[model samples]
Target: MKEKVLILNIGRCAWGRCIFCGYSRENYPEPNLLRMKVDLDRKLVGFEGDTLKIFGSGSFLDDKQFPREFRRYLVEKCKKKGIKHLTIESRPEFITEDTLLDFDGIDLTVAIGLEVADNDILKKLGKGMTVEDYTRAADIIHSKGFKVRTYLLVNPPFVDDIKESLDRSVSFALQHSDSIVLINLLPHANAPLFDLWVEGKWKPLTREKFFEITRPYANNPKIELDVETFRFVPRFPPEKRANLEGVSSEILNHPHFRVWQEYLCDWYEKPKDKTIALFLPCSAKKPYSKSKTHTLIYKTIKTLPIFKNIHRLVISTPGVVPFEFNDFYPFNAYEWDERLETPEIKKEYIKVTKKRIFDYLKHHKYDHYFCFFKYSAESYIALQEACNELGVSCTNCLSRETYEALKEEKGNPLFKEEALKELREVLSKVKQKGT
Candidate 1:
């Protein structure tokens, strides 16, 4: 059975201040109701799908975006087109008993953005609506004999454990929603979250992380993994953002996972033909650039000819961060120190780091892998184990004598003359090879 789905974008959303959303930036002062009707009519012409998803960038039920007369008009239009079911988006605040009452005869599924179940996390996201609001809307939707679909972000910002928080959120949303839509948070320009990303206060989940988080719910029929964040990429000026689109696109195209998958690949996929990769250890400071050790490393490395050609990556707590993203989110923000944590914590860190290394290796292609780390560091062990497992050899930029000397020290070993000399020699070889 080919489940035909037609998704139409209408008016711009209201209450656009959700820290993670970029829609509000596009929702300028305009006569949305008039524009929405024109957009709707154009899309609905000769409509041929079992399910029609009407997205107004906000609440489709809101009169400001879609007026009462337009609601009646849409109902007639859908009925005439023999549209079997209509899925429309709304904010919890805009969904009321009276609002649902307006579309009385239609088979409707009302979708609401309940990004996370935790109220504190919701507040941090600047979602504006509370759990109570969503539940209240869901109750009204149910009372009106409509289906409730809820949206959840896997590993949302400000969350501690990606898997745990997603588990809790999915569990909670399932109880209230007839269906659930899951998407990884995607950072976009103009959103408040983008600013956080720039400042190293937040980061969006990678495709691998998203898959891992949503895998538990894949078998559940009620759960819909919104792979659309990866597709139908909204265009933005090149100067603003190169490829990434808004988070709202994920919400709008939840069922079109293929489209989303392609889009995500375009945004996050690494260039596979790179000739050299330098895997540096994570820093204690937020944004490795701010750390004294990393600062010295960069300063020393930049003097080498190969530095201009090699891909710079950080072996960090969150995962492998391309040096360009060192200033973004968890890469820049996390303060986890294995030295002060419990054994279990340390074990988990090693496991996660190793898994990330494997994931990175699986996706990225590099002719040479050079690592600069304290010989005894957990990151080094993890990367070494991954390389060994994959039959890939990685050269260490620290000599055996230098590693033995500082194997027990707390100071920055990379700053030492021996370490610097080894780094220079190894990079010199790379430069020579490139020539």
Candidate 2:
């Protein structure tokens, strides 16, 4: 049987934050009953397939996207038009019995984006829903006498073991889904996974890998392989992220910035030693080592006896970056100044930074945590909040009194004598713990 897919617009997704979603770049018109009906008529003019798969920019069951009246209208229209099977996509959260009602005469299957099985990996992709969420939704759909189609993403980003993740995801999907659609994760310039791919942290799955991973499901009638997606997985280097002319506030507000922040903290493996972690603010200069302020801070930090075991990290615009990754693509590529950002962007920065810092500290244990930044900096606020939540003390190199004293200074506050004095005093108190 021939299959026809219709890509419709539904204004925006309820959760449009998936790192691998290319639809984030799309701007859809607000869903109106009359307008959507007209658009659907135009798209259905030449429909000839026995199976019709309707894909909206987001969930088809979302009332904001498809009103109840329009939804009933569409189902009746499809039945009238002699369409035998209808497939529609929706996020698991929207798969309630009320939403799935009124389509008794038609054969309907609700497709859900159940990308992965592991909750940790799902969080890294910013999927916004967990495996359990998908399971619950799937059970509801099945109980309502409707079929569930699971969209499985192969070789998603931030996964250390590709085969294991895919294997787990496929196994989990099989148990919960009546049908499985295998999609090779495609790279989009506007998506977060693209940055990870560009930075060499992730790569596209090879044809060999795809075949090997999907071998067990080859004979299953329910598994539908999406061969076309693999064709669009760009293998060439992405030119958009590099060689940009100058730093602008727009770059910091982009979606990739948030993804970069989440992945940076998620992927980092802390050092084995129970060493002191010294968090410093990023500089406009690339690699941070090239910045004059960072150079002076490094010089001063080296003088401390505990410095021998201290691990230096930058609380950068892209979130935390270890000193060793200073030369990495995003770490070295972008420049940011909190002053240039709008109030909204700055507030988001603080929220994202705080969560990331908390998550990083939660996983990566350190004997001691200390931070040296301008007392009034955004990173300082986030670090303080994160440390407080963890019940761990993070010594601030620049004391509040010193920040008050130097806030109005002509030069950078970091270089002032009082700030350095505070740094020395704080370091002196943190005795070097045995490695």
User: Which candidate ranks first by TM-score, i.e. highest?
Assistant: 1
User: Model 2 off-target regions past 4 Å?
Assistant: 46-49, 230-240, 244-435
TM-score of 2: 0.54
Locate the minimum summed-lDDT window of 10 residues in model 1: 251-260
Candidate topping lDDT: 2
lDDT measured at residue 393 in model 2 versus the true structure, 0 to 100:
92
Q: What TM-score would every model get versus the actual structure?
A: 0.57, 0.54
Give residue 413's lDDT in candidate 2 (0 to 100). 88
Cα-based lDDT at residue 5, candidate 1: 49
lDDT of 2 by residue, 1-435 (tens): 778788886778988999988685567778788988887788888777677889877898888878888888888878877887889999989888888887776788999998888899889889999988999999988888889999988778877787788788888898988899987776775677777765668866545567777777778998987744623523223455544323354464444455454444444355665388989988878878989877888777788777777888788666777787677666687767555677777787788778778877876788888888876788899888989999999887787777877988799889877787777778777876542
Question: lDDT tens string, model 1, 344-380?
Answer: 5556656766766776777676878898888777788
Candidate 1 residues lying further than 4 Å off, grouped into runs, are 1-12, 32-35, 228-267, 270-362, 366-435
